[model samples]
Structure formats: structure tokens, C-alpha cells
Target: MGLECIRGASLAPLNTFGIDECAEQLCLVHSDAELREALALADQRGWPVQLLGGGSNLVLAGPVSGLTVVMRSRGRRVVRRNGDSALIEAEAGENWHRLVVWSLDLGLHGLENLSLIPGTVGAAPVQNIGAYGVELCDLFDSLQALDRRTGALCWLNREDCRFAYRDSLFKQQPGRYVILRVRLRLHTRPVPRLDYAPLAAAWQALGLKQPDSRVISRLVCDIRRSKLPDPARLGNAGSFFKNPLVSAEQAAAMLARWPGMPHYPQVDGSVKLAAGWLIEQAGWKGHSRERVGVHREQALVLVNLGGARGGDIMALARDIQQDIERRFGLQLEMEPQLLGN
Candidate 1:
């Protein structure tokens, strides 16, 4: 199907949070042309359009009142190769984890560290998704997107994207452009980044002298699986809050108080503190109120027990944010975007 539209579509299945909500209208587009058609249709009807990918990073706080377009375009290929480096492209709707595996199969490096991230390739650049010690921007080459304002497809380079720790131009200006495809620069050589303590320790335990991208990917997946709850079994987003960044002075003050709090110093003279550690230290780990609560194993994650509403989840998150501010005097920013209300 080129463009499929449904009225009063249930959004519970679209979002990983499993929030029970409905979209006034939902359109599934399988190609860039279809996507454009859907947008034109929405405009003709005077309805606001909302774009959704894997729905792994959104919260529906209320019923969606406009046209919700789901990106389902599909394609992937090796664009060109030169010596040890190669350029690869993937359609917006391809699964992120599958793309990582495909790159490894082709003996390409750089994407192995982001293995098992739950979302589409299109959504990856929006959040500049990262794991272990690698972010998408590290490997990103360029992307083709449709400028909604001008209706022209254009390419954006790395500098044009303006990626920063879990933030990007797409996120900064939501709904301005529709990403059609993404290109990443990869390598034929195995270049592993095992700076994260847990992953590095696991690698040492393996006792392997050779750097293997596939093995690194497996280890990252194992670590994530152990720490995060499966969205299939439990209704939840991967992480509820972004790790809070504070000034060097602020970090020094907190370290003096807690002494053992986990913090990573950045080159910009800022410190990235673990959001999970803060929640756990504040005694909210494994805490539940009604149908929403913090994950028992990972405090940064807020899970849906069952039959939970969007408002309930936000209320729980609000409580956690207020408590963290009261206890630590730092604000906790939510990672997922709110889709409604």
C-alpha cells in the first residue's frame, strides 16, 4: 500500500509505553511519495500531523487529535567503499539493531557499540542515540530529509545536524523535516570502544586479545538486557530520564556530600551524573504507586505494571522529579517526548 489511513486508530500498539490512547486519524506511509501525500491530505483537512517511528521514545499523555503518520519505508545498501572505510545507507524505517548486525556481517565497524537500541534508523539521529561509549553522530555521515516548509529533499552533513549528548537538530526543531534515509561511515577494521567500566570488565573477563566488533555487540546486548526490562513483557520506555549534566563546581559540591556518586567529567568542564544512581539514592528504586513505578533493576527506567494511563505515568515521573530536586537540588529532564497534552 502506498498510503493507508484509518480513523480513530488505537495508539496503544504504536507506543512502547503501552499507554491506552487513540489517534483521531492515523496514516501509514511506505515511501517518501506516500509520506508527502499523507502530509498534503492532512493539510487539506486542516489537521496537524504527528510523525511516529518505532514509538520507543514517546509518551502519549492524552488522545492525539490530528493525523499520526507512521514511517514504514524500507531499504539498505552499501553506497560506496574506499580502502578500509565504506559508506552505507538505510531507509528511515529499518530497525536499528538489524542495521547494526547487517553492518557487522559486512565487516563494517563503528555501529557495533550501539547494538540492541530499540527504534528505527530514522529515530536514531533524532535523539543522537548512544550506548557504551559511542553515539550515532560518531558514525553518521549524512541524511536525506524532506523539508516540510519548502517541500524539497536535501542532504545534511554531520556539522549541519548539530548533535549533542542525546540531542540533535531534528529534536531541536520537531516536525520541521521528515527524514527519508540516513548514511553512516563505517570501517572494515575492528575498532572497539570499551571505555565503559562494565563493558571493559566483561571484555577482560573474556580474555580475548583480538578486538571483535561482533563480540562487543553481543556483550553490549547482554549488559543492556540484564539492566533493562523488555518492552514486550513490560510496558516501558528504555530510559525515563536523561542523565543530568551539571557544572564542574556543582559536581564537586555533590561529590563532597555523597563522595561515591557516579559522575563523568566532560571536556567542556561539565559533569554527567547518572540519573539512575540519583533515583536509587533517593530511595525510589523499585518504588511503585498505582500502576507506574521505577524499574527494580534500573532506577532510570519507569515501567508500566499494567492498565496504566498516560496521566498516571506522568504523575509518577513528576513525583520522582520533585523528590530528586528536593533531595539533590538538581533538575531531572525527561528523555522521551510527550505526544499529547
Candidate 2:
């Protein structure tokens, strides 16, 4: 019922990368009161506070200092339901994939395309998580967060969150707000989004008479399992880099040079280039050096081949970033947050 504290906690098991590092102090808080108490305790002791969720989307760069607070709060339920529409709320600690399945079980649509993403509900808006043809912002109604600056609980709407491509207000101003829970607007009527080519093809292959959210979710899981590695078996943070967006003119030039290169045009007169394709083209796919390597199946994923340190992972990532920049004149931004210096 209170904050569970540990000193000199090993963080290797917490992160997906399994980087061996220790936090000076770690607190696992299961409720808002506990979280606030943990923060107050850290502040009183003059220890810097670092937040963590599922640990699926971060890089433990080195041994962390001060107090590390892990959000472990949990709950999920339908807040309300209207004619063919519903509003659902979930506590921060709820697993993302499980939330998707829960929604489907409730006959809710909209989250099927984002079924297999890692991390918890609290971390979703931080990265504006997206997959297949859907993004979290599409259904995000609002979220309850503790604003550190004011020490007050606040409700932030979709526009208030300032959601963008893999970005949000929570990410823009880190350490300023702690997301406590999230609310989503979903539909009871089937309105599947299969805009992604591969998803559409897989759906077509099924040849079902009508769209089924569960079936769509299964297909998504199947696709993700095939492309991404299981963190338990092979230590990895899925998709190490964000797909770079280039100007229309830049995209035209790149297309002219490599006709086979994959590109997706945005409504904002920009083109999104596949980061994995660029990395593979630069000959880094399956490339290994002692303990770290690029995943053979997914060039976007950087894997830790047992006994790899945080420094080793960053070194590989830097090499890949440099190569992609040199080869394509594009910068591949890392998707995972670096937790330490």
C-alpha cells in the first residue's frame, strides 16, 4: 500500500535491452498517493527523480543516479458508452497490448491496428505511438496527469497534448508531468483501418466476409512477431530509429537516384523514408561487433547479444546513424529514450 523502495537496484532486468546498470534508489509506486510520496521523499533527500514505466522504450546509458520511480498503478474499465461509441479509461501501468485485447473483447474498434506495440498506457502518448495505419492520438480523448510544476492533478485533451508524428507535449517537456491515466474514445461499430499495404494484403489473404477486430488484431500480432524479435529471447528495443521525413524536393532527388527505395508521402508535402531500408542499403543489416548487432530480420532494431553494455549499444547506434547520414543525407533519430548520461 506504500511506496516500495530499494537501494542500489540493478536495472538490467527492467529494460528490454538488458543493459546492466544500477539506480542509486528505486521506488515502485502503485498508486497516485504513493507516487506523490515517492516524489516528495526524493525531493526531501535532494535526489533527482527519474520516471520509468514498462522499460520497453528506453536505453539505460549508464548507472542512474538519484531516485528512480517506476509507475506500477493498474486499472481499466469502460467509463461510459453512447450509441455505438464508448469512452474507456486505463491506469498508467496497464500493458498496451492487453488494453487492445480488452477493448476488442468489449466490441470496441480503433485500437486493432496498434495491437502489438510494447510499453504501458502511460507511455503511449509520450511517443504518440503508431503502427499499421493508426496512431494513439487518433483515439486519445484525454489523460490525467500530475503536473510537477503546480503539484496538481490535471486533465489534458488531445489538442492539449500536442500530438504529432511520434511526439507529444509529455515528451517535449520531460519531467514536468507524470501521466496517471488515459481515456480513449472508441466505437462499437466496426471501422477497421487497414491503410498500411502489408496489413491490407494480409486482410485480403484472409478473404473474410466482414472486418473483425479480433482477426485484425491477430494478423497484426502475426506480422509484428515475424518482423520484431522477442525481447525475452533476444534483447532488443523494437525499431531503434524513427523513419526520417524528407522534403518533397529531397524525396524526389532520392527517388530519382534509387528508384527502388520505399517512400511514403505526407499531407504536409513531406516524404517519410523507411529507416530500416536505408540502414539495410548501407550494409549494416546483421552486422555485428563483439556484443552488439543490427537485427538481421529488422534493420531498424539494434540487438544486445548477451553481455553487451550500454556503451556498446550506443556505439553501434552511432555508427549506424553516421552511416545513414553519410549515405542518404538523412538523420535517423533514435526512438528509445536514453535514461542516463
Which RMSD does model 1 reach against the true structure? Answer: 0.9
Tens-digit per-residue lDDT, 37-60, candidate 2: 999998899999999988999989
Count the clashes in each prediction.
Answer: 0, 0
- Residue 183 shift from truth in candidate 1, angstroms: 0.4
Candidate lDDT values, in order:
0.93, 0.93
lDDT of each residue in 1-341, candidate 1, tens digit only: 45678999999999998998999999888888898899999989999989999999998999998899999999899999999899999999999999999999999998988999998999999999999999999999999999988989999999999999999999899999899999999998998899999999999999999999999999999999999999999999888999999999999999999999999999899999999999999999999987888899999999999988889999999999999999999899999999975
- Candidate 2 collision pairs: none
Lowest summed lDDT over 10 consecutive residues: which window, candidate 2?
1-10
- The CA lDDT at 124 in model 1 is 95
